[model samples]
Target: MTAWAVLAGVAARLCALGLTASAAWLIARAAERPDLSALGLAIVAVRAFASARGVFGYLERLAGHDAALGRAAGQRVRLYRALAHGPLPAGSRGAGSGGGEALTHMVADLDAGQDLRLRCALPAIVAGVAGTAAVAFCWALHPASGAVVAAGALAAGLAVPAAAAAAARRLGARLAGARAELAARVMDLTDGRADLVAFGALDFATAAAERQARRLARTERLSGGVSAAALAAGTAVQGLTALGVAWAAAGTGAVTCAVLVLTALVALDAVQPAIPAAQLWVELRPAAARVRRVVRADAALPPDERPHRPAVPGRVALRGVRVRYGDVPALDGVDLDLSPGRSVAVLGESGAGKSTLLAVLAGLVQPGEGLALLRPARGLYQDAHLFAATVRANLLMAKPDAGDAELRAVLDRVRLTGWLDALPEGLSTPVGAGGRGLAGGQRQRLLLARALLADPEVLLLDEPTEALDAATGRAVLAGVLRARHGRTTVVVTHREDALGLFDDIVVMARGRVELHDAGDRQPIGRAFPSA
Candidate 1:
């Protein structure tokens, strides 16, 4: 399809060149003799070329856009799938951080790659073919004029664009950086507006955003200036080249000279867009590099290459498990064993690696130097995410084919049955962005219901009852444990009331397991001295 588009574009430019030359010849010939009959074939040929030019130009645009859009769609799907399945490596800031700024930048980069095919490569290819044809046609008519036209075409099509591209390359990185910074600042202002106002920092945020906006505007002005200058230079070259063609063909008859000069002028039309195309080519390079880096990294460490799901879904063991974030260790030389159908509660202070341990079990964070073997597990993190979707839609993420009965059962298990029943729309009620419509406890219960619906062999809960009141927290915890009677479960929490219900209790300090005891005997505060 792309080849067809390029061919059509080249054909259209050639037709345009023919139309200009033929019209000039017919007018000059009729002026010499005042005889319309002598110019009949020339007039007919001019109209034919004009008509064909318009038709082929339309076809070229249609085919070119179709091919480019299809390619963009495919690339977007592959990139999204790669990011969805795994965590990006540490310190690698691709799509994970930068929030909407990163996502919008990535999408713009993909569009740039698509435009390279339609705008840069296609125009350059078409111009080359059409310019060569014009030079050859002029040579057949008058050899001396041919040389002059060829020189001008080469200067306009090659030298000017190359210089423009080189200049644009110098500014491309700075322009890209400014745009990203602006995007980040705008997103920060939007997402943090409430917090900024509460802390009396709204003015500070506004000033920062204005600074980034100014930088972006300055960079854009510079880029536009470069593009305009390059275009003006190309047009100047075309005018001088047209004059030279006419001077060289002066001895060939007035009619012939006029025809060749007009041909030279029209041939330059094909080269006029080349300067901007070259600038775009240079501008797309950094974005392409960023995209390729992410795609290549994703390819190197595929998400599916992790440890397989255990066959019997019973024991989970980790030995000498270690994970380092930069120089500091988040989990260091930790060992744990979870027996089948037993509940283990991990108690720790804020940064005691309890969450990291759960991540290791859930196969989210790979161990640096250790062995971790576990069955398929579903995790409910302390900050569980909820989309801006309906109640049923969110629940369907856990089990896509679940009916209303299954959904209602899981909601009941999490003690959200009464709350959901009281709603006007029940399962159909909308959960606003990040579950904004619901209270913190309601959101937590919904997340718990989702995890339960998944029914994995192992359940990992990170502060699952943190959002609820004392009475409600204890009831929800009991219900969760009861529902998982025959499955392995790991709970990471600071709460003490639920500690007695677990079969084993593990306390973590720093990055290591400090104590492990049977839940029945040891007091919660004694096990966790700081707590």
Candidate 2:
């Protein structure tokens, strides 16, 4: 399809040149003879060229856009699949962090790649073909005139555009970076609007956003100036080429001279777009490089295969586990053993690696210097997401083949059955993206219900009830423990009041466990002196 588009584009440009030359020839001949009847052939030829130019131009656009959009769709799917199966960087757990920015930037890069094919490659190919044919046609009229046209075309189409691209490359990169920064800042401000207002930081965020916008505007203006100057230079070369052709064809027949001069002018039209095409090529170079890096990264990973199922349920052990974030250790020399039908609650201050421990158990983060043996586990984190879908649809993610009875059973286990049944839509109630339609406690309960529906051998909960009140948190925790009585469960929480709910409690400080108590009679605060 793309090849046909290019061919049609070249044919359209040639028709444009032919139309200009034929019209000039007919006018010159009519002026000499003052007889329109004798120029029937020329008149018919002019009409044919004019009509074909419009028709082929439309076809070229239709075919080119179809091909480009098709490729874009394929690229998006490939990129998404690669990211899904690939190993993500440490500390980037969800799209709320820098992952969203990275994905958005990659998408923009893919778009730029498509634009390169459509605006740069296609135009360059058509211009080269048409310009070559124009030079050959001019030579047939007069060799000296052909030499002048060839030299001018080369200067206008190649030299000027290349220089313009070089000049705009740095500015284009700056503009792209500024645009990305502005978008990130805007998103950050929007996401943290309440916190920013409460902390009196909204003004600072607005100022930062304004600065990025100004920088982008300035870079774009400079790039536009460079393109305009290059275009002017190309136009000047076209005018000089037309005059040279006319001078070289002196003393020839009026019709012949007119055809050569007009063809020279029209041929330059084919080359005029080359300057912008070159600029776009330069601008897309960084985007191309980014896309290449992502593709290479994806290729380096092995293809995803089905995971091996666990032989037995409710067993998780980590020996001498350690994880580092740069020079600092997040988890240091940690060892844990979870037996079947046992519940362990981890209590820690902020940054005490409680969440990291849950992540390791969930297979999200790899230990640097230890061995981990875990059964199939389902993790419910504070940031668990809910898509803009119905309640039934969201629960189905945990068990795709689940029926209405199974869905209701899990919701009932999580104590959400009453509230959900009261809704007019019941299971069909629509939840907004990230559970925006639900309250914080409702979202947490919904996530718990989904995890219960999965029926995993091990369950990892990190601050699962943080959004609920103390009474509700205890009730929810009790219900969750009751529902998963036979599974090995790990819960990370800061609530000392709920410590009695677990069979064992582990207190952590810095990156190591400070105390471990069994039988659930220990005071949680006494184990952590710093807290």
Candidate 3:
């Protein structure tokens, strides 16, 4: 992929060089009467070279785009898998991350990086190579001409650009920082739009956007100012080169004059496309730093690649399992064993590490201190996501070949049969973005359906019914009751109403197990008459 990408960039540049040389050659011919056959043959040579260059240019773009998009896709998939190996904060990895929306990492940053790679660096590097060689060739034609070309090449491509780039760095960095803050703020505002509007902060969000726009404008001015300076420098050099070539040609005559000036003009113009790409290098550093931080973040994640899944006998045990974010331990010295065919409840207020514990259990977070053993379970996830795909597709995500009848049966068990039936496409109805979407309840149900489809022997439920209403929540709870069947289910929830459902309940406070007992409440007796 890297080879293909590099080649593509080189090809686009070859074409540009051929086009410049052809234009110069054609101008030289227009002034004289060369033989018809020789002129025709020369024209054919340039045209063929230009045509071949264009073909390679197209191929280069195709290959580069594929490489870039493929790399971005791989990065996203790796990120998603990495997220799977631990817990996503707030249960949903798609959104609510402090970094803002997943798109920031997945689309925006990736696109920016890829653009720099394909459109800027490769082409500039290619042209730099070709132009350097061309300048040397022109010098061999005339030593004085060679000296001028070399001087102009370094001055235009290196010296001026270096100085301008240094000047633009601070302005560019500030603008980049502003853009990042704006992107994060946009994500935050979008996530909390309802709260913002209800609290009458819509104006504030708008003003925030405006402020970002103003900063962006300032950056634009800075960039424009830099580019304009580059043009001025190039024009001044070209004008001076033309005068020098013309003055030196006074002894050599007009033909030599034309040749030197033409060479100078062609080589000077070669630096134009190169200038922006060179500038982009200066602009892309901060973004590169941001992406590097994300990539290197994984390096700090302790390798938890256990060669084999432990045959943990129908019970989960966290032996001194601890996890710290920065300096604060989210789960510290935690210990527990969740047994088979039983439901355990973990209760804690926000920031008491309820979600952190849940993440550890789900295998999404690595404990800073100890081992988290999942006993006889595939995995655990909270508020799991469904793609912008069909209801059937979402369910099939767990077990792709599980039959439509099987799907309907699970939906019926989850009490979502009516919901699916009401959909325009029934089981095939799309959900999530750009689809015949579901509400929060429906989305959660689809997630639940996905989990159940896995037929996990032990169920880990993290606030599964939080999105549902009183009656609906109860119905979902009843579904869990039926679904639990012989499987052990560990749940983290706050509602006192769910106390009856568990065979045994464990309450957690500040990463410590506070309550571990069978229910004393009569609701369990009524709900499970046989028990």
Off by over 4 Å in 2: 34-41, 73-114, 180-215, 247-253, 282-531
What's the ranking of the predictions by TM-score, best on top? 1, 2, 3
Candidate 1: residue 196 Cα off by (Å): 4.3
| TM-score of each prediction | 0.65, 0.61, 0.59
Cα lDDT of candidate 2 equals: 0.80
lDDT of 2 by residue, 163-197 (tens): 98889877766877888898999987987788999
Would you list the clashing residue pairs of candidate 3?
8-60, 86-364, 86-365, 87-364, 87-365, 139-146, 322-368, 323-368
Residue 523 accuracy (lDDT) in model 3 = 39
Which one wins on TM-score? 1
Give lDDT for model 3.
0.66
In angstroms, how far off is 115's CA in candidate 1?
3.6
Per residue, candidate 3 scores C-alpha lDDT tens digits across 1-531 of 477756665555555555655555666676676667656755775787778777887787787788777876776665555443333322232333322254355345556676777667766676677567657766766777767777777777777767777767766778768888888888768767888999999889979888887878878787788789877987787677667656654565555556667766766666656666767777665454444444444463334423123355346677787777888767768887777677776666665677777767765565667776665534545445666778888778688899999999888766798988888988877786523356777777777777787776667777887888867777777777677667777777766666676677665556666556675755332322111
Predictions: Cα RMSD each = 6.7, 7.7, 8.0
Residue 233 in model 3: lDDT = 88
Model 1 weakest 10-residue run by lDDT: 84-93
How does candidate 1 score on lDDT? 0.80
Which candidate, 2 or 3, would have the higher TM-score against the true structure?
A: 2
